[model samples]
Target chain A: MNGSIADPKAVRRTILRNLRSALLELGSATKAELSDRLGVSFPTVSKFLGQMEKAGELLPVQLDDSSGGRRANRYSYNPEVMLGLALFLERTETSYIVFNCAGEVKDQGHAASVLTADITDFDALIAALVNKHPQISAVSVGVPAAVNNGRLIYIPEYEQFHDLDLKAHCEQRFQLPTVIENDMNAAVYGYYMARHQRSELQPSLVYLYFGQNGPGSGIMLDGNIMRGSSFFSGEVSFVPLYDQYNFGEAMRASHPHPRFPDGDLSVDAVARLIAVFAAVLNPHGVILSRHEANEGLLAQLEAASQAYIPREHLPAFILSDWEQDYLYGLQGLSLDLMLSREAGGN
Target chain B: MNGSIADPKAVRRTILRNLRSALLELGSATKAELSDRLGVSFPTVSKFLGQMEKAGELLPVQLDDSSGGRRANRYSYNPEVMLGLALFLERTETSYIVFNCAGEVKDQGHAASVLTADITDFDALIAALVNKHPQISAVSVGVPAAVNNGRLIYIPEYEQFHDLDLKAHCEQRFQLPTVIENDMNAAVYGYYMARHQRSELQPSLVYLYFGQNGPGSGIMLDGNIMRGSSFFSGEVSFVPLYDQYNFGEAMRASHPHPRFPDGDLSVDAVARLIAVFAAVLNPHGVILSRHEANEGLLAQLEAASQAYIPREHLPAFILSDWEQDYLYGLQGLSLDLMLSREAGGN
Candidate 1:
């Protein structure tokens, strides 16, 4: 029985939710184990498990060792029972990944850049992917813009996609749960989740990127993405780090490419930004892409940062693949939607 | 019966916790109202209420009007059942407030500056307060330093208080639960709580203060204090906002007093700091003490900040009483401890 002793439908929802979470955590569990863990009766667990199995949400993976009687069936969540579609719309290309509930990628591809095209192109691309993967249960898209609850509220040059309720549009068209996240937000979440150990531990971190879209950051404080009051938490482009120029203008003046610039001006700006993070946030780590933060630049940054703040206060500088982290983040969001949907018995 | 069908103690704890929160929300409620809200059996609620009433933790407020049935008795949580001692150690003086669970100030006073004096002096002040208020159940101390889990890990001028486990020491000495918080954290929380409407709505804000010691800030995001990884989230004095000087250095160079300076340099620096918050945190409000901000200075800051970031992204600048907010925040913390203790039936 649900602990609250609420309405029956609400009780069932709570029981199924707990059972699903336990199954995910345990990998596989016999009806008795789930019953013991959830404090639900054995018959209650058995009924839900039977219903879920009939709905193709669970599978009998193995048999529990018999003590003195018949062996009990150990059931596991069907990893491929549902699929998720993850996509990122970048400056020049649109990349996507189709993954299962277990986060295993089944297909990956690229399409034309949606920023310069119409919303229909983006819709058609998703439709194609959905048709190919008929089991797709959720969709998550990442865009380099300030997103407010799935609406592209601020997109400087991407006017074609500006003010679009991407989540609502996609959900309506595909009849699936959809999430739209800011690019940097997704990247930071992906980076945070990529490390299995760190995923369990909430680590405050800042992921900085000088992308084709411009300089931006993703902030994760205590394991949560800090989407600021106006959903502009990671828009570091306008941060005035100098007397005459902002971060974006200074970066553009120092270098043409997204790679780390060796110029003193650019170096000072990056070091100052890191120092600001150290003083204000004091995060556990400051993550940067390997393409933008080599050993030599990292060394220079560490030394330069000490001039502004104490060395002990600085966070660890990490190098990661931004592309991989972004896709992983999108996949993670999609998987969450699928799990909640399943728990809701939708 | 307990709904969990497991540990009766745990179930009782949950029900009591829920009941306490509901009563606090509803102000006063009848036994049947609590039983229906908690989804616990009427007998269970009746038993707990009876025990709590006998313990003096609850009071029979009045009787509800009969609706062709028995007049139900409305019970309320006893506001004076426990008291909380809240104190802040400042450069010039130590201010304290004794408040009850209902947030009514029972007493408030100030003592000699604890920074220059010995920790014994601080303890004596608390002892005196506790002696007078025998019902004091929790203690909360706010200090101007980085606090990691109630330990004063960073105290620049006050070396005597450095590395002191204030919470543990106080709890042991007074035989009451204690909490130690950073001064700015308390101030921001107090400011956040002072506005009852905002308390219900989570608004991201930064409370900046330039005091006798130095400049510090408290950050509130979605209604929770942003205590960074190292418990150094609001230590913004070292932020290298300018090439030659950090925020503190620049401010000191521009002004002698901890007030809004008329110099253009200070104005620019303040504007830039606001711009940084705009581009990064984008908080709903940037709070400042009335002593440190005025109409003329605020206008200059608004104009100067436009050079860095767009006007649309700027947060509303708010002026509040720093001292009041700090004390209120400490009281809020102590009240939380008291509430949890009452719910635990301890």
Candidate 2:
């Protein structure tokens, strides 16, 4: 068999890719540790690390402690490679967070609602942000609306933004790639990606997000977000909860019931939703986000499962920390955009 | 440029592959029709058709009469090229049907029951069928049970079949590849494939099968059947109807209330389920089988959608022909298995 030498450019790219992955996973690493972890020789690692540093891909942080010999410099990923603006539009507030390539928050601010009453304020905000940070690679917006192909299909209190085509509008104005997703769908995507990094998540799960607006689902099949035929999937807010139980009254402000039905996260509603999820889709697990999930709700869901589903067929119910998962989702998408640019031989 | 000659073996395989696909789609065709459709020489088509005919892969069914020229022989794909015993286990009676590579029904019969009580009888039945047809390709069984890894994880009526290891048992007994699927899962798969052939179905839809045993859901995403986390995605019978109503009573024969909650499909149980499906998944359409679905039910569902979901967010409700969807599903699976064998370079 003839021994062939590997391509030097390919080898260098592989080394860079491995180093970047390790940095992302570990947050920070020293040259010696990276060499040991990547199974590359110290001199070769040092050579590539020097080149990467010159290329502005790695940044030197503090030096690592050494026993006696000279200390090695600890390096963190150079997040300034690309910038992304993540806009999380809720019912009453539109939160904007800017993150560099490293998925670290660099800048953030909160503003008045931009989508419910009108999209004029949102248009102004984007124009100002684009002028402020012309270096941003992409813009991602997550809104509390039923989105289908970048158009707002429904948002009870925010009918003015219907058929806005905000994604197209943003792209046309900014000249940078922009993505607009339903807030709950984005959250579900972020939750799936986060749980998958730990390697404990199943290939399929549904994340139920209940916010000030209402309940919605983010369905992940094989760890990817599922947008139905028209991208109208996961509108859980409209899920009819027992026609006689005044579930609709919660939606109507006039005949207001407990806000639990309107994202209160109480007992019967959660239990019934879990049962329906189990019986309908049988996902490995269900993740509840931004809900008042407590031990009482968990107990009721489990006890009810015993009556409806078999002992073995019950799905695990998980309560997510009330963090801005939509921001994480936006950052993830921004990273994908940056990677696609590289894949296209940028 | 060097002109490459097609290998006769690959060419003949391609011809056979195309012919098989056409037969599955069109049901039957003549040699002249196939030649014209496939853009092959008439002589070549005749040569290969002759070989396939001799090998029982196809059969001469009827004659295509001509005005002046000699009458041509119309050939239909032989329904016994590769036989598959498809068993659809219901509550009381187990229906069996056999199909060929073209998914045409060959032979069928059913015993009193299978997998509900004991596997001893099922084992004997399988053994008898094996003896009856040694040329059978595979055996596909669809059981009314929530299956996890080919084992019955949940079955309300037949708790005895829980953890039965049914697929392994059939494989060991028949010495052939076997597949055991949730009854509703297969029905959904079958329904999806059948509708997709006509190119009129949606990319995402759910088939609700209400059998005598209970209700089950078959979810299809992008024309593919989705078996959630542990193959337990579609156990719709467990869906809670109301916060206070006894929806589980219908499943428990002893605690039977007035068949349905309130016996009025307009408000509580049925409408809510449809509304929930529309809100949560937003599938393009919903197919209802084995139910007393009528125009009144449709009117009520539309009215409820107006109350819960947006006008544009409603899914078209379809009533399935109450024949046997599970049988169609089993036939589809068996056909796939046979084609896979051929694709593996058999």
Candidate 3:
């Protein structure tokens, strides 16, 4: 069996494929176990393992004792061998991070530049990261807009981002796969991943990201992100709750005094604006975050939300404690997409 | 192989199992092909086919011709071998239907009984169905409420449905498998199944079902339903939309009524209610149905929804034209579950 495969590329692909299958099934596996399960000759498996180790694809772990025989060399995929880059672009700042395959944050970076400044600046920032870290395998960007087939369709106040080919630009620069998702959708994915890992809660989730602009929601049904037809399903800002006159006036009204003289309304004011919206679009819970969300604010919003429940039926409200790490969530989404493909053989 | 199996029960189970497997892999095998694939003697296969025919589980189709030989008998699974009953219970009426395995409607029944009505009446209705159609293999009931682990936690205005052992009661009386799901979740499933069969859309969906009470949402991510922590994630009615008020009340206040009495709302009132909800939660598209959404009502709702979206971005709304047969969707879910199990086994 070892001599059966002649092409080196085919052998490498086969080894990677088998290793992925083993990892997916058992989370980890030893070389001997993989050899037996894959029905490949032991020496062939050993050779592939050695090559993977040399390429930093597999890390040799401590040898496990065998029954009355020599110890077997145990190996696992190197988490750091490949990296994912995720960027969460807010109206005020851009949050970015590097994540390994196991979903651990390896490095983090942020820049306080308005996303609407210029597309060239955004490209430069991403290029700087790629130059700084060569191990990145994929890049995911989350923006506050409606995305249709990886294209930016609408960005409310930021008309500059409309029709931007963010995915193509990133992929062209880094020569890696790229994903561009709505900021709210990314928040939903981030919350879902964090909850799944840290809590024993049910896997289904409806995540509402309350920012100053408005509220955006993401639905996770049966542990999968629910993107509706046209990829704009979670847009909760349009639901009508108040008189069109009052709602429009409130939206256009000047920010109250010195706090926002620049006229950039704070999330709190947006929360108030959405309070009227909330009365109409009652959700399971509303999550507030400014890149990062705190428990105190969540509690405050939760209490405030209670006043709106007409029939004394208040849904649970949770404040996200996770670092306003929208980038990490994008990394998780990429990893999820990869893992799902591997698991389902699609 | 037939001689090797002595037990009649084993034979019956094997026939069922084989027939199901063959039907699932429709184009992959023929009766003769299955006979060879299962490694059963051809005569045994023939005999089992005969028995299944008597049981209405197998139907003889056109024969396949072998070169210069007698045409081989071709048999396929009879879709009507088993039946599923699906009941969608709303505040005002109950929509019920029976479906065959192929998702075709066999029969349907509707009643204008409120969900707040006595459980005994609901039971009586179910009993009447069982008496009328003794061949129903399973029953699935969809209610507009929050369910946690198969337990009804809340039913909003219909308090009588709260804490009801819906599953146990149905199963006990019919001695068949029964499942009770959130109505919105079931609606999403029905919508997804219908669209999947027609388009190349991604399997993940955020389904919003608009009604007078409020909009119900179901998240189907990656071909599976996402149930929230308490199995209530998709409960859109609780999502705070306007000025911290529930969307339902906000819509009522925003769109003042002259039609219905101050408190009692009509279907038109509900339609107006949904129009406001649709604006806030701009899902992929809103699905509208009458008491039991028919073709005419669906078109009307689609036309009405267009008014909500500014003349610029009106994504195509989908009308679920899947025969108005809830039972078929139930069967599809069951079949999908079974196929997933089989795929997992492989």
The candidate maximizing DockQ is: 1
Task: Report how closely model 2 matches the true complex, as a DockQ value.
Answer: 0.28
Which of the two, 2 or 3, has more DockQ? 2
Candidate 1 per-residue lDDT, tens place, A255-283, comes to 43322345547887888888888877789
lDDT by residue (tens digit), candidate 2, B6-46: 23455556667666767667778887787767766678778
Worst 10 residues of 2 chain B by lDDT: B1-10
DockQ score for model 3: 0.20
Q: After superposition, how far is residue B189 of candidate 1 from its true place, in Å?
A: 0.5
The Cα error of candidate 3 at residue B226, in Å, is 6.8
lDDT (0-100) at residue B267 of candidate 1?
74
Q: Model 2, A195-258: lDDT tens per residue?
A: 5753344466787755554555788776667776556666655565553343334333333244
Per-model DockQ against the true two-chain complex: 0.47, 0.28, 0.20
Clashing pairs in 1: none
lDDT of 1 by residue, B144-246 (tens): 8888888999888888888989888988888899999888899898898767542266889999887756788999888888887777677778876654567
Question: What ranking emerges by DockQ with the best candidate at the front?
Answer: 1, 2, 3
What's the TM-score of every candidate structure? 0.86, 0.72, 0.63
Candidate 3 local accuracy as lDDT? 0.58
Chain A superposition TM-score, candidate 3: 0.65
